[model samples]
Target: MKFAAFSGVLIDHSIQEALQLTKKLGFDGIEIAAREPHLSAATSAPRVKEIRTVADGLGLDIPVIAGYMGGFSTASDKESEQAFSEFQRMLEMSETLGASMIRVGSGGPNAFLAEDYHYAKAAFWLRKCAAEARKHDKRIVLEIHNVSLVETVESGLRLLDLVGEDNVGLIHDAGNMYITDTDYGRDSVIALGRKMFHVHVKDEKRVAEAGSPGTFVNRTKHGEEKFLQCRLGEGEADHQPLFDALKETGYDGWVTLECHAPFPAYERLEHDFRKVKQMLGLA
Candidate 1:
């Protein structure tokens, strides 16, 4: 798989600097942040041009755009309209950047209907968004985030089935699921192996008794207490099974490493990138 990095960790740096860091770390591509002071191709066309120039100058390809952040579902018409607008903006950015895919996640867990209705709403928005994406020949890879309601393997698979669009796929994150009490290392990989259009490589270490009033520590508490993001093989994330699944499914996309620990983010990011490369046998 081609390796990449998310620009969020480099929030303090410029887009060109982030791209340079990515190249130095041996990444093949990048997942640009949509919000500024980062890189939003939709809001800043000139920045997009500069980014394209830099990527071309470095011989790197931008396969994915990660600038979409407003996905909270709304029960009211006004909110829904706002959410749709945000989606449109993200799509526009994706199109401008020539990114084949855009990464997005379900908004806040405000609970949209249930069962058929839930699927209906999701399909309604996804189909509309997919139609727009099709105009630019782009795809939307929905992300499975722990804070959201639909991050589980079953939920992701069900959404894919309900949406029933080849243009829609998932951006699977191993550490996110692992921290959410899901067997993403094994089950999720098996469930959505082929449906994963992109993958985020991350791992978290559980710290007990770091804080809180409860004795029984779980994924949520453990994560909050001692959430240590680490390289692929350095944490509790089951890396071998995930890699095996990736190989079995023939997924050829960037394995973007996300750094969310307390350490100097850039230093650890480079370390994790190299670790993933060596472990994935891409080095």
Candidate 2:
């Protein structure tokens, strides 16, 4: 498996600076976060060209472009339209950025808020997005997160079935899953099978109180679990099982270390990268 850095961590850094930092850290690739301060659809084609040129010059791959798009399952037509339009622009941007996958979200608690309150509408838009992505040979991967339509692998698979698009898949996020489930382990990958399009790595340990009320705390069969983001190995959540699952599944893709911890960007990059390398025993 190849390791990459998430540009979301380097939002304060310019795109070129981010690419340089990633290269300096010996990362195989950089997952570009397609949002403000880093990139957006408003960014001109020439600027994007410069970014691509710099990354290619550094011999770093752009595996995925993270887009903060949702609202497919909304009650309001305007909201859904805006989301799709943004996604359209992102698709075009992704084409120029040389990324094969676009990270997206399922409509979170807004409910998309349909009267029926089901995910059919979200699936509809995802199908359209999948078709559009296919034109560029890109895949649309939804994050397995809390408060979203796809809070679990079972629901995510159901959404894929509803979308019925072969290119649409799910990102296996162990940190998020650990918060949602007490037994967040190898079973997720085993269940996802080939539909596991990408993997995000971040570590969080169970805490007495996460400070922000109702944020990280969740009720599970094992009672309650509250979490606080921590350095990779220092966190209580074990990444070894997740890594072992990836190895067992023969997943040959970018295992991106998402730097969401409050530490300095460079420290998180080097430390987490080294820790993950040691955990997976990758050279």
- Give the best candidate by lDDT: 2
Tens digit per residue, CA lDDT, model 1, 55-167: 87887778887746445343455665666677777776666566888875555342222345655566667777778778888888888766554667777777778777789
* Candidate with maximal TM-score: 2
Candidate 1, superposed: residue stretches over 4 Å from native: 70-72, 110-119, 209-226
**Which pairs clash in the backbone of model 1?**
34-67, 71-107, 72-107
Clash pairs, candidate 2, are: 73-112
TM-score, each model?
0.86, 0.91
Q: 140, model 1: CA deviation in Å?
A: 0.5
True-vs-predicted CA distance for residue 276, candidate 2, Å: 0.9
- Worst 10-residue lDDT window for candidate 2 reads 108-117
